[model samples]
Target: MQEAAGAAGEISEFAGPSEEEELQRQARAVAQPDETEALNWTMKKFRFPLERLLNYRRSRLAGEQARLEKLLAEQAGLEQRRAALEREERMVNESLRRLPVISSEQLAAIASFRRFAASEAVRLAAEIHAAAGRVAAQRDAVLSARREVEVLEKLRERRLHDWRREVDQETERQTAELVVARWALSRESG
Candidate 1:
C-alpha cells in the first residue's frame, strides 16, 4: 500500500500540460490558420489602420481649410480697402458736384469785344477763361480716376468670387476622397 500510494503521487505530479498552455496553443493555431479560410469579421475588427487613414485625411482637410480661411481673410481685406477708396472717391465727387455751374452767358460776356479795347479787362477775361479750363480739366481727371477705381473694384470682386468657388470645390473633392478611402480601407481590413 505504501508503494501504490507513492506511485499514485508520482502519476499526479507528472502533468502533461497546464490548462493555460493548452489555451495558448489553441490561440496560436487559430491565429496562424490557413490563409484561404474565410473570417467572419466586420470592419470594426480592424479599426486601427482605418482610423489612422481617416486621421491623415482629416489633417489634409485641415490644411486645405486653413488655406481657404487665409484666402477669405485676404479677400476681406481687399474689399475693405476698396470700400475705403470708394468712400473717399464719393466724398471728392460730392464736393465737386456742389460747385457752381458756369453759365453760357458768363462765358460769352467774358469773351465779348467790349473788353478787347481795355488791356486790364482783356487780361482779366483771359485769366478767368484759363481758370475755367483748369477746372474742367480737373473734373475730367477726377472722372477718369473714379472709372479706374470702379474697374479695379470689379476685377477684385470677380477674383474673390473665383477663389471662393475654387476653395469650395477643393473642399468637396477632399471630402469625397476621404469617404472613398475610408470605404476602401474598411473593405480591405474586413
Candidate 2:
C-alpha cells in the first residue's frame, strides 16, 4: 500500500482539488458494502497508479486458481482409474485361484493375465505420480497469484483510507474558514 501511494504521488506531484461533483460521485461509488466506513460525508478521488497492475494480477490469480482446479480434477481421475484397475486385478486373481490347473494352456493364460495386470498397475502408479507433481506445481502458482491480489487489495484499501482522511481535513478547514467569515461579518455590522 505504501508502495502504491509512493508511485502515485511521484507520478503526479501537482496535487489539486477535484470538482465537487466528481468527489461526490467517487464517494458514492466507494459507499457500497461499506456504509459505515464511508460515512465520512465525502471522499476525494483515490487514484492509484498501479490500478492496471492490480487488475492484471487479479486476473492472473483467477487463471492460476482455475488451472489448479483442473489439475486436481485430473488427479481425481487418476485415482479412479487406479481403483478400477485394482478391482479388475482382484477379480482376475480370485477367478484364477478358484480354477483348477488342469491344462498347461490354462495355466499359461492365467500367468499372462497376471503379468498384464501388474504392468497396468505400474503404469497407473506412474501416471498418478506425474499428476501429483503437476497438481503441486499448479497449487504453488495459485498461492503466489493469490498473494499478489491480496497485496493489491490491501493497497487499494489504504489509498481509500488516506483519501477519506484528506477529505475530512479539507472539510474541517473549509468549516473553519466559514466560521471566521461569519464572525467578521457580524463584527463589521455591529
Candidate 3:
C-alpha cells in the first residue's frame, strides 16, 4: 500500500503544469512586451507645414473679392447717377418743347445746360469703363489666390493620406506580432 501511494504521488508530481502555473505563465508573457512594440514606440503626429500660407492665401482671396464688390458698387452708383441725369435731361427737353413763348436768353440758357449735361455724361461713361476694368482685374486676382490655396490643400490631403496609411501599417504589424507571440506561447505550452 505504501509503495502504491508513493507511485501515485510521483505521477501527480510529473503532471505537466498546474492551472495556476499556466495562468501565471500567461501573466508573465503579457508583462514581457515583445521587441516590436519597443522598437515602434510611437508614431509621429500629423502636421500641415503650409497651414499659415494657406490661411494667407484665403485672406488674400477675400480681399480681392472685396475690392471687386466695392468696384461694382461704385459702378452701380455711377450708373444710377447717370440714369437720374438722363431723366432730368428728358424733363428739360419736354419743358422746352411745351414752351410756346421762350425768349432768346432762355433758349441760350437751355443750350448751355444741354452742353454741360453732355460733357458730364461723357465723363461718367469713361469712369464706368475704368471701374469695369478694375473689377475684371480684381476677379483675376481672386481666382489666382483661390488656385494657390487649393494646391496647398491638395498637398496637405495627400500627406495626410500617407500618414494614415503608415499608421494602419504599424497597427497591422503590431497585431501580427501579438498573434505570433500568442502562437509561440501556445506551442510552448502544448
- Give the alpha carbon lDDT tens digit for every residue of 1-190 in model 2: 9999999997665555557546544444443325664465455577988899999998999999888898899899989988998898789778878877648987788788888888988998999999999999998899999998999899898988888888889879856755665565555446
Report backbone clashes per prediction.
Answer: 0, 0, 0
How well does candidate 3 score on lDDT at residue 179? 79
Q: Which candidate leads in TM-score?
A: 3
On lDDT, the candidate that comes out on top is 3
Backbone steric clashes in candidate 2, count: 0
The deviation in Å at residue 77 for candidate 3 is 1.7
* Per-residue lDDT of model 1, residues 59-95, tens digit only: 5555555555555555555555545555655675575
What value does the lDDT take at residue 31 in candidate 2?
A: 33
Higher-TM-score candidate among 1 and 2? 2
Better of 1 and 3 by TM-score: 3
Cα lDDT computed for each candidate against the true fold: 0.55, 0.79, 0.85
lDDT, model 1, position 90: 63
Question: Which ten residues in a row are the worst by lDDT in model 3?
Answer: 23-32
Report the Cα RMSD per candidate.
20.2, 18.1, 8.4
Pairs of colliding residues, candidate 1: none
Q: Which rank order by lDDT, best down to worst?
A: 3, 2, 1
